[model samples]
Target: MLNTNNVDCCARVRHGPSVAGLQQALGNGAMSNSISDIENSKCLLVLATTAPTPIPSSPAG
Candidate 1:
């Protein structure tokens, strides 16, 4: 059920000034976090070349 209206937009606008200002000051956005490169992906494949060994390494002399 979707309502085509300006629902909650005013409240969001009223509360978003500081957030918007900070984003604007920070050059639009930080873009520091990781995002999914694939859109609507059916499956993801992760390949690890090296597996961790059960043995621990000794300290160097």
Candidate 2:
């Protein structure tokens, strides 16, 4: 929320291009790793500058 940090593009990162096609052009790769894929897989290589936001946390019961 604060722009004081030199790192801008908080919003852009969240909506950035998924980069699913560029690499695929050179190798065997899935077109896109959709949210479902990330949720279903046990092992994942998450490469993000920031953790995903807006995916509301579970309610404390």
How would you encode candidate 2's per-residue C-alpha lDDT over 1-61 as one tens digit per residue?
Answer: 3766555443344333444444557453334557897889989775764455553233335
How well is each residue in 2-29 modelled by candidate 1, as lDDT tens digits? 7765333332443367567658887553
Poorly placed runs, candidate 2 (over 4 Å): 1-9, 13-31, 47-61
Cα deviation of 16, candidate 2, in Å: 7.1
lDDT (C-alpha) at residue 5 in model 1: 56
Q: Best candidate, TM-score-wise?
A: 2
Ten-residue segment with the worst summed lDDT in candidate 2?
10-19
